[model samples]
Target: MDNTKLNDSDPYSIRGSHPILRGQWITLEFSIIIKTYYTDSTKVEYRDLENQRIQNIQGLEDILNSEEIQDSEKINVFTNRLATLKNRLDVLEDLLKTFYLDTSFLDHVKKVRKEIVNEKG
Candidate 1:
């Protein structure tokens, strides 16, 4: 009576049936998960972008303070670029809300998994 949990090394593990219906459901759920994952990942990327933008603005301020490169034109250009980056950061903040909404997408995943399990049994 060998009672061992399923392991990767086991060749005869019951990985379950490959029914088309089940496969399709699983695929759909997996796709949703991936989409949600990507959305969440993008939020992190946006945060990093925001941090980089702040750093850039700080550096520009430092440069403006120094007597070197005291050209008004160059300072104006940097200010305009900083404004653009700030606008982009605002857009990314909105996208973060959308990414949070994506979390509700998991309800469908749970429902699908339940249906598959019930049908298989």
Candidate 2:
């Protein structure tokens, strides 16, 4: 018998599972797109809102702690602005979670998902 092996050059033999690999790539691309959208400075307004909230919080703290009597109107305005900022940030967070559903960022979650699904089930 000849020593040559059959199907050595087959793409399927070399590539393992093509469909599974393709699915992984598509998921990765989608995850990257969502992460880009979440972090994009120009499109997302969370950065500014967060900064404004921090400044307002600090200013409010200072005003409240001062020896002089603080203006009630200013306190009310600051409280209202803080509440609005928090609501906006919460909404942005929920949107981000809905879009970026990949768990690869957390190694433990990735491991658990892979193990649970891949094992004897």
**Which one is best on lDDT?**
1
TM-score of structure candidate 2? 0.36
Per-candidate Cα lDDT values, in order, are 0.47, 0.45
Local lDDT at 63 for model 1: 70
Give the per-residue Cα lDDT of candidate 2 at 18.
57
Candidate 1, residue 39: CA error in Å? 19
The TM-score of predicted model 1 comes to 0.35
- How big is the positional error of residue 35 in model 1, measured in Å on the Cα after superposition? 19
- Model 2 regions lying over 4 Å from their true place: 1-69, 104-121
Off by over 4 Å in 1: 1-55, 101-121
lDDT of 2 by residue, 13-105 (tens): 423345644445444544443343334412322233544322333344455556554688777776676566446544543553544454565
Worst 10 residues of 2 by lDDT: 2-11
- Model 1: number of clashes? 0
